[model samples]
Target chain A: MFELILTLVLLVIGFVFGQIAEKRHFRSIIQREAETRDLLCFNERRIPQDMFSPHVTLVCGSVVVSVDFFKHFVATLRNLVGGRVSAYESLLERARREAVLRMKAQALAQGATSVWNVRVETSSIHQGQRQGIGAVEVMAYGTALVPR
Target chain B: MGAYENRTVPEGINVSPVHPLKDFAVLLFGVSLSVIAFVIVLALLAGYLVRYVPFSYEQSLVSRAVAPWLEPSTDPLDQQRQRYLQSLADRLSSVMNLPDGMQVTVHYVQKDTVNAMATLGGHVVVFQGLLDVMPNENALAMVLAHEMAHVRYRHPIVATGRGFAVTLALSALAGIGDGVMERWVGQMGILPMLSFSRSQETEADALALESLQQSYGHVEGAAALFEYAAAETPVLSLPTLLATHPDHEDRIRRIQVFAQEHPPAMAPQLQPLPDYMKSKAKSNESQ
Candidate 1:
């Protein structure tokens, strides 16, 4: 009986807090993206020969986001049904966006005008067993082009 | 870079626009519903298949596992008590029309727990605590017959099989989640199992009441056993929904309803307990 009550309480807390946190993070990401709009990013490897003396440096940003209890529960359920696990969708979305934003910030800090050949990679870091704490690490790396 | 400009993509493109709660509600409802349905079907299949297992198999299995522990008492008085209870059970079974080759073996236990139970292999155990509280032989017959009814319906085996299947399946499903999810899944499985047990109890009560009416031509004292039980234990305090057995008050009400529906032809007579049984009960109380 105690376990049942505790599970219910944890579910409610996870859902309420997780929802609030996701909403707030999304708001922050949108606002930050608007502020950093002029920092250009591209997947193209070729650089123009006409471009004036530009300093090149490698820039990278990485972030790890852990799953909330409610999303974990929903995902466990989804495992049985074999469907699109929407519970982790927004989680990865946040991680991927955050990684890019951080990479852009790194380039801007170096007085770079644009990033070339940007790349993003994601991998899950399992803390313990299969059902234990789960988090995803996303790393965005690119070459920054700064005019001297 | 083409034009060297990064256009701001509109929101809600990558992430699904479906609200989290809506997705959660749908998945929770659909997944749990299917799991519960699957469990129920498995339980029913197990219970149905178990009934096909020969009663002799159940008897042999229990004899190997449990019968040795239920050794008959060596004390002369205790043996006499066991014999008397056994005879009473035999008499009730004769009128109750128990299926051929099925028999009830009554074991009189010398304890003071105020409890009686029926188990596999048609074994009904009557504790000394329960015997001491009997108001009359009629009430004793009601209690004995109730256990006999459980044996008649093969409830013990059916319940065992059902519970085993459900637990095994639920535990396997629970392996997909952590501690909290495991507990939650287990609790869901138990609800159906408990309800099945409660319905079995109700079925036994009805059959026992029928046997009581047949034996005494009236069920006037049938409710006495539950009344005595209710007085001794706070069993009625538990919520009826969760308990395996129905509340004592609910059982008494059922007995009263049965009696009212099938009026006896003659005046209701509650038989007094035989002198040896009464003496044995008194001796236990004194000790």
Candidate 2:
């Protein structure tokens, strides 16, 4: 009787410990981004011809989050979550907002009226077999047409 | 308190039956513990079996078994096609900045089936039927790019690992029941391969677009290529393939959105076929 009771207790304890371990593993993976910045570039043809400011042209900009940083965050989060729905949503929202703000800043810097056809992308840099990181990455880019 | 004590029943009436209750509790506890112990033993046995027999050996055995069943196509242009494919692969390697000792091989099958595929270890095969329908070099490059993307992404190996785990699990389950196990093994053997192929196709598409933007300067060709494939091929209608890559329209929309957002770095310089090859291609078209 004592042996039976002890076995039952051990089984229950094992199940509880398993659940706790799984949850802790999940929490560790669900980390948030620490810092981020935009990778910027400009193109001359993206602006309307009518907008004229001497020595000024449309500034087309792109944003590339550090592939290493973004991947680390994603992998850690992926360990906790089964699906990418929540993570991708957070990433896309942040990327879109950041892209718009950066484009506006570029336009203002050039003293232009507004930017047009702003776009964003998510891409990855593929390196192989690194620890605690994703070989895949996400990158975002947009076009900002300024005066000239 | 004194009035309540005065109202108490006789000894037998007040006392409970401890023996029967204790016996029932002990029996229930014993049965549950036995079941738990049995499950633990089975689990440990499974873990031991897996540890002893390496998964790679099983994979190779399966691969060899399947190799005999796969139908090989016979085509006359297989050699010339191979040469052209090699040249294109060389160009892609240089453009993608791949490391030394990496090799790519292309196969041309004579089958009239409208299909093209890339397997692991950099083997790419395209059916004559698919080639016959392609309108231009860019469209062809789109297909090649998609396949190359599979290689670059290492999707095939990942897929193989997943397939092995699923197969092993199913086989273990089926081993317990003769009537159901046979049917299940038969079904799984056929279905999993098709599903894996389909998933690789989708991954290739996504990676191919990324590769196109990075190497060729735009994804316009990739989008057009997918549109063409959707129109020309009915392979997507297969149940197993459909399960992996559903909604052609969704894929098109996603690719277009991606292309729009990440425009190519520079305008792509189209590479024209050599004069002799162009003439031969024209003659083939005329025929």
Instruction: Please list all clashing residue pairs in model 2, or write none if there are none.
Output: A29-A76, A29-A77, A58-A146, A123-A137, A123-A139, A124-A137
In CAPRI terms, model 1 is classed as: medium
CAPRI band of model 2? Answer: incorrect
* Model 2: per-residue Cα lDDT at residue A50: 56
Show the colliding residue pairs in model 1.
Answer: none
Q: How close is every model to the real structure, measured as TM-score?
A: 0.93, 0.42
For model 2, residues A15-60, the per-residue Cα lDDT tens digits are 4553355345333322211111222232233544554345544454
lDDT of candidate 1 over A1-148, digit per residue (tens): 6776776787899999999999999999999999999998888788767553457999999999999988898887777778788889999999999999999999999999888889999998895676676899999999999988
- Badly placed stretches (over 4 Å) of model 1 are A52-54, A127-131, B229-238, B274-287
In candidate 1, what are the lDDT values of residues B12-108, reduced to their tens digit? Answer: 8777677777877887788667767777899899999999988888999999999888999998888998999999999999889988889999998
Score residue B162 of candidate 1 by CA lDDT: 93
Interface RMSD of each: 2.0, 29.9
Looking at model 2 chain B, report the run of 10 residues with the lowest lDDT sum: B1-10
RMSD for each of the candidates? 2.3, 34.0
Once fitted onto the true fold, the runs of candidate 2 whose alpha carbons sit more than 4 angstroms away are A1-148, B1-77, B178-200, B232-242, B264-287
Candidate with top lDDT is 1
